[model samples]
Target: MSVRLQLTDIKKTYRAVTALNSVSLDMMGGKIIVLLGANGAGKSTLMRILAGLEDPDSGTIQFNNQTTDAKSIRRVSTLVFQKSVMFSLSVYGNLAYGLKIRGVPEGEISKRIAEALEAVRLSGFEKRRAKKLSGGEQQRVALARAFLLNSNVLLLDEPTANLDPNSAAIIEKAILAKKSSSRIIIMATHNLNQARRMADEIVHIHNGEIVEASAPEDFFENPKSEVTRKFINGELDF
Candidate 1:
């Protein structure tokens, strides 16, 4: 089934700072939408809102045309952080935790765990300690954990930032492989090359608002906004 996520007039604030201002967007399944912006540009804030980790000060979210709340969104969305967060346990144990809580059959959990590990290219490391793995390995494990949930919406914040080239490439490949007609994948990144390579559509956000959104080709070659031009030319100071 195809899924559609719509955000309308979303606004968020943190004390004296406005994190998101009248931000609105629409996303559909089967495409990778890259949110391109510098640090402190509200990308993370918007992601958190989508993930149900934060409530917008003013906005409406519709899933498949039905108005929804944070609780409902949380059930169908998964957000992977920029940093790798792992439990102090074996990789298998970590991956099994969610399934266990959800009472998934033991056999089914094992099968899914294996498939998820293989997706991240860490199939045989299930017995290893998650925290003991290298940075790249840990991040892979994190991605695997998120994938295992099979959420309809996947939100990634700087997914490959600060990683070695190989790990980044592997993660990117895994992400692309996961795209399907029933899922919507949104990634936030500042890396122009990565965005250009992976994004079907690119949305530029600056100062807590969306500047423009377009296909990658037009986003780079024929930007309509001066802010986007500055961003493309490496002139935006954040």
Candidate 2:
């Protein structure tokens, strides 16, 4: 019953700059795959392509044994950006928007919103304007919004960046709570510590290519590449 995703020979370019170079990965069911990279290392570009925000110049994507298009990919997968955005609406409104678009009934929408807010530990803030929340609070709300959507696949980019310890912990709890055998989570981040805590597998990208992919323990404690070693040693910036 495991879900599976496969990308073969993926490539992307921006004018003369290659953002991804024949990258390929095979991922399956209910595991966290953390993408690590320095700045401009193509982590975001790879995530965006997977999220269907941008098309790979050349590639094939197969999810659950079926090839799919961007719209179809997005229907079952959701992405939360590094800079979270909330509409000029109440928290309840923001959370309910996607459900409404998907034609969920009003009763179900209310129930999901309540559950999502509780999951994110913002149970009493539905009536508050989303934009009025603090950065951490806003990110949590964004996360709650994604949870309410209940997509089978989720992608998060720098989800806890710049947050205080408490807020990050809360967000981490929400993420862990959402993990299930029926879902797949792919996250891109620069936080080595967070990656260590959250990742089942770590994929290291450098110069738009995946240089290393391994289990977290092996990746962190016994990296195989000089680049991965340098990264763990804090010798590389970006």
Candidate 3:
């Protein structure tokens, strides 16, 4: 039941500067794809576009083989930001807040909240103040919140940057544990090893364009692009 999300000839320009130049890529569902690039390399920009938070100057986004409005697409996508916003509330409160905001029924909310916490391996730290939690704990809270949404897609930006390896692994496990009946997960990461560990497809971006797209095995073993070669060899900083 996995479906592919397609971005066709996407272009974004800021004032006189071009941020993305006709970037086209296909992302298969039920698999993780890592977008690798340096700072200001349009990685985040592309994620934002996929999350429906930014509008491309030109291009089309098709989800599940159908073109649709951004709002509809957003309903099926979860965008986990680099810096998550935690409400001034308890961890349990934050975890269940999204369901509350969405007006889920009380019974369903309770069930979903519990399932989400379990999914993120945060079964006990419920009443703790979110602000007081460690960075990793707070991120797990966000993951729980997102999981409760049961979205079909995910867009993450540097999710493990501030997290300890243990906590990062927890979140990664959560992402990978989701039901693959119909889902897609995309992340923009600077961590090459993590990318290799998680991504099914490796998308190499530079300056403001996608230069290489390949399966993880091929991208690592036989990269075709100059930038990708330099990247795999750690010659390029990004």
Reference-based TM-score of each model: 0.98, 0.97, 0.93
Clashes of each: 0, 2, 0
Query: Which candidate, 1 or 2, has the higher lDDT?
Result: 1
lDDT (Cα atoms) of all candidates against the true structure? 0.93, 0.90, 0.84
lDDT of 1: 0.93
What residue runs in model 1 are displaced by over 4 Å at the alpha carbon?
A: none
Candidate No. with top lDDT:
1
Compose the digit string of candidate 3's lDDT tens values, residues 1-238.
7777899999998898788998998777778889998888899888888878878888998988898567877878888888877999998788777788789888887777778878877787778899898888888888788777877788888888778899999988887787475778888898888888898888988888998999888888998999889977889864
Sorted by lDDT (best first), the order is: 1, 2, 3
The 10 consecutive residues of candidate 2 with the worst lDDT sum are 176-185
For model 2, how does the per-residue alpha-carbon lDDT over 1-238 read when each residue is reduced to its tens digit? 8788898989999999999998999888779989999888998998888788888899898899899778788888888989989999999999999999999999998888998999889998989999999999999999999888878888898999999899999999899887787788998998999999999889999998898999999999899998999998999755
Worst-scoring 10-residue span by lDDT in model 1: 94-103
Query: When superposed on Cα atoms, how far off is each prediction in RMSD?
Result: 0.9, 1.0, 1.6
Give lDDT tens digits, candidate 1, residues 95-129.
98877877899999999999999999998998999
